[model samples]
Target: MGRETNCTEAADTLQRLREVPIEALVPVIDRSDPGRLGAWQPVIDGDFVREYGSLSVKNGDYPKLSLIIGTTSDEGASFSKLGLNTTEQIFDYPVKQILTAKIL
Candidate 1:
């Protein structure tokens, strides 16, 4: 959301947000498992890593925050040319990554 502005004060603002502490977050918990943990949002490191740091790369000093950066084939361009995009197109990569990240 941080696009460099004509005055660049906008750019500075986003950079500062990147340094903002993770909101009342519990990155280690997830409602996805045990079914008994309730609906607590999981604190995935990916959120901390990508939050606004990547979007604010124009003039900001990338913080020393640990982030898990990645991309999936879920992007639109592949299907954009064909005018069709769906989760089916991304089935393979998501499944593969889930399996691989488990071991590594």
Candidate 2:
């Protein structure tokens, strides 16, 4: 039930963000603006995020549970793109590319 709510909210937010131009997003991101985090948020995609983090609690998936939530003053600071800036670059950016980049 709670998973559905979280998934719905994330999907709604992602849909709203997809309508905005990426060019407009670049400046706000470059400035590290805290208010422009909507685009950087996790979407309710079944691939990357198979289920909401809280779903385990509802489904009794975990035998033991320990939860911790942390906050950063500048959460957007970590969103710096290594080389992906242009549309072409973004299109070429795949899940493997991201994983490889992080590993390197």
Candidate 3:
């Protein structure tokens, strides 16, 4: 499908999900395609996630405190794909993810 169409569908799905009971989401998540599942990132609700993480960090929008950055050993494996061999594809992935998040 075209990117715009996909984005629209994703936005619609998220809208519909708002009314679904929290318990109902488990089956929906389980049945969704592994990698193609909609963006599972934090929503940029104005009150909580006011802006992008990098922008918040750059502007010092968050509370001043000690920070920790760590990841699980196989965290990258969940996002691995076979055909993204080029630099552009690698970079484009996160941009698309950000765009999808914004659309919701």
Candidate 4:
């Protein structure tokens, strides 16, 4: 599955018909490093298609077809680029909302 704030879960459930017999991944999100994104990731993405992704087979009696889905394009890059340093900076502003600080 995923950690948090990842669209993979939604995409997996919403658009799993695209790929069959293949489960989707979580785009390898950042697990450590404290930050808004870090904190947010696990809160939501921990259950996207259950990481291994979901396997759906068409047909009741006979398994004629199977559908699979994984993290979409760009989502991986977006998730990868987002590090504690980058996201933490967002909290540095006057709000000090937590996202203002980054590891960088």
Candidate 5:
């Protein structure tokens, strides 16, 4: 079947990727998955990341130098639905309602 063939090809590709070094594969992964939502993911290599971001910060494993973190006003608009023209439309969005319905 078509599904089986696709699965075999995926397995072969995964095997090939596994054989490649991480240094060589990182650029390929970055190029292939610009959104970083694919099979490959970032790992805590104990040098840079060390652990989960929050945990690293809490344990003082992160840099102690001054750091400023900020985002633009429209940063969250990217994740919101399109056509949200008016303030009323943005406020009355069904995201909360949908989340509440799913949670309940």
Candidate 6:
């Protein structure tokens, strides 16, 4: 919900949020058919999160702390199932390439 911009825009957004009903602030998530739905993500304000966190590591911006990297087998399979057409198409998807680029 937090996005970076000029002061004017930020103030405007704050005003709108204040006027909007609290119920509207709740994100809608569809577990049954989750495609292009709300996601939990960090806002890149250029200070704490200057870029995609993974890209920062790949670019050698190692943090002064321990780190962890892993993913479950078939992590995106459920997502791909609902978002893609066929199994063949899923196999052809560039999931590996995208991960390699972000990690290496």
TM-scores of all predicted structures: 0.20, 0.27, 0.41, 0.16, 0.31, 0.32
Which residues of candidate 2, in runs, are more than 4 Å off? 1-37, 62-69, 74-104
Residue pairs in candidate 2 whose N, alpha carbon or C atoms collide under 3 angstroms: none
Q: Best to worst by TM-score, what's the order?
A: 3, 6, 5, 2, 1, 4
- Scored by lDDT, the top model is 3
Model 6: lDDT to the true structure: 0.57
Worst 10-residue lDDT window, candidate 6: 1-10
lDDT of 6 at 55: 89
Q: Which regions in candidate 4 have their CA more than 4 angstroms from the true location?
A: 1-35, 38-65, 79-104
How well is each residue in 10-104 modelled by candidate 2, as lDDT tens digits? 65766655655767655655555444556566676887766766895688755574766788764434454555555576566765587779989
Question: Cα deviation in Å at residue 86, candidate 4?
Answer: 16
What tens digits encode model 3's per-residue C-alpha lDDT throughout 58-94?
A: 9988888788778765345336664564568767877
Clashes of 6: 0
Q: What lDDT tens digits, residue by residue, belong to model 6 across residues 1-104?
A: 43312224555777755665545444322223455442444778798788987888789886667776887765465456565655677775566656667888
TM-score-wise, the better of 5 and 6 is 6
How many clashes in each structure?
3, 0, 0, 26, 0, 0
Scored against the true structure, residue 56 in model 6 reaches a CA lDDT of 82
Name the top TM-score candidate.
3
lDDT of 6 at 51: 91
